[model samples]
Target: MYMPWPLPDENWFADTSRQPEPDHEDLRLEALVAQRLSIDWTTRRQQITVAVQNRVVILAGVVSNANARQVAADLAYDVPGVFDICNTLRLSGPRRSHR
Candidate 1:
């Protein structure tokens, strides 16, 4: 009698194995966002994190003020291939008092 080889586990061919790599457009978008944030004078570099997914960018972290938050959002929006922006940056700095 001849014996057949054992079959591999079903999970071995799961979605992870066929995962797609990041395309050029996605990389460019991430770079663009980084550059914009780096060069902008209004942004607080230490308190921001940038994430790019499916052409949509998510901005998360703490900022000095609302303007900084808006600046981040606008910078991300200007990048090509950016489908949408989700600005989740929180403001934690002391408010400026107007005399």
Candidate 2:
């Protein structure tokens, strides 16, 4: 068998395990959520604050009823990559539970 006289050696210890992390995805998601909640549904628009940290969403605002609370939670849950959501959204009206 014949081989090259001056062939270079192949790489055997190259580092290929480190991956770059995303920087602003969480901040963008939080801002989008807040904007969606602040939109006016009926005659006048209400203000709702949304804060997201490490895929956990926290909602704080004056909701109309339990339905509103549920909707808020659902909205946050629908977002992709959500781990645990903290629903602190308070309702403005009275409380009524089906169960």
Candidate 3:
């Protein structure tokens, strides 16, 4: 039966069907996440792992010192549209002693 306002047709059971697609918000979020992951910090390359979700970026990895950690956080902040950041970076390497 055709399902139309003040109109009905026997072809209501037509084989043609509309497929649902991802919402614009979902697409936007996905694009932003991709951009976040693709970013590479020049100061610390091997000591970082970044994950982005819903505009929130999560960083989990190892660093050499407090300076390195600062670098990581700053990198996350540099990415546009990043509203939240969860830093879970562990410090590594020996601390430089000041004489």
Candidate 4:
């Protein structure tokens, strides 16, 4: 059996606009979320992890308190691509005084 050579679109070679691919949107959104999270100095950004899928943001990790968790959620919301948020942050319990 013989296979014919594949035909290429005429404009494909001429177009050099360097448009972003579809999959790149996720990375772009993730970067945006990370940037927003970093902007807040109070929250422990290092302890949290952000997951973005289909425009929904899922925040997971341990925070010092409920307010910190909420702050993480709010940071996620500030990103333009985030459509919904699922906050899974856990509180680390009350801080005990060290002797």
Candidate 5:
């Protein structure tokens, strides 16, 4: 067969892996998640942190209650391109109160 251009070697595609690279997509995801959490009334006042890597969303920081924690996770999950959710939210203060 006649070729106008030289064909590349196999090594040309060797570096193409499925590993996630730090790019604008990750930044966009992070911003979207943060925006969702900030706008939602449940997580509006909570100190929740959102991080995205390889389309996976990581929710961290402390919340006032379990509902807030779940809300954060849910909001992150709702974002597009979110492959998975890592919820590491902790409840602030003691679990139970005594008089």
Candidate 6:
């Protein structure tokens, strides 16, 4: 009589002993936020720095004006996994009046 092969145990493919890396999610969120900011026209993407921790995004760097700063925050918020935005962008100077 021919016999069929036995199947492996449920844990055969999985290494349950290892814990998930915590920084992976943070890094992914950071990249997403950064990409969003980079493509936007309102904010100075090159001057901005993006950081993520526990799903919270921190925007740090120099922006042209208050509107740019707010735009950065809004862009970050558009990311799917972003929990909060810490906008620390500083304005270069007051806007000059155009004649």
Q: Pick the lDDT winner.
A: 5
lDDT by residue (52-72, candidate 5, tens digit) is 888889888999999898878
How close is each model in CA RMSD to the real structure? 10.4, 14.7, 13.9, 11.0, 11.6, 16.2
Which runs of model 2 end up more than 4 angstroms from their true locations?
1-23, 38-44, 94-99
Summing lDDT over every window of 10 consecutive residues in candidate 1, give the lowest-scoring window.
5-14
Candidate 1 lDDT, tens digit per residue, 10-99?
A: 564457766677777777888889888988999846488887878889888898888888989998898878999989999996779999
Give one digit per residue, the lDDT tens place, for model 2 in 7-94.
3765446566864553376787787666555553520243357777777888777676677677777766777766667888676765
lDDT, model 6, position 62: 91
Please list the residue runs of candidate 4 whose C-alpha ends up more than 4 Å from where it truly belongs after superposition: 1-22, 94-99
Whichever of 1 and 5 has more lDDT, that candidate is 5
Better of 5 and 6 by TM-score: 5
Point out where model 1 deviates above 4 Å: 1-20, 44-46, 94-99
What does candidate 3's lDDT look like per residue over 1-91, in tens digits?
A: 9865644655656676775665565456545543544464444354576665556767787866777677667766766666877888788
lDDT of 6 at 79: 85
The reply for model 3, stretches above 4 Å from the true place, is 1-42, 94-99
TM-score of 3: 0.51
Poorest lDDT segment (10 consecutive residues) of candidate 3: 37-46
**Better candidate by TM-score, 2 or 6:** 6
**Which parts of model 5 have CA positions greater than 4 angstroms off?**
1-21, 95-99
Q: Clashing pairs in model 3? A: none
Model 6: per-residue Cα lDDT over 1-99, one tens digit each: 998665775555677789666698899999888888888888644489998878989888898778888989998998887889898888887678999
Q: For model 3, state the Cα shift of residue 60 in Å.
A: 0.6
Write down the TM-score of every candidate.
0.69, 0.57, 0.51, 0.65, 0.72, 0.69
Best by TM-score: 5
lDDT for residue 76 in candidate 5, whole number 0-100? 90
Of the pair 2 and 3, which is ahead by TM-score? Answer: 2
TM-score of model 5 (CA atoms): 0.72
Residue 8 error for model 3, in Å? 40
| lDDT tens digits, residue span 1-99, model 4 | 998665674454566787545456777887788777777875745478877777888788888878888888988897786789989988887778999
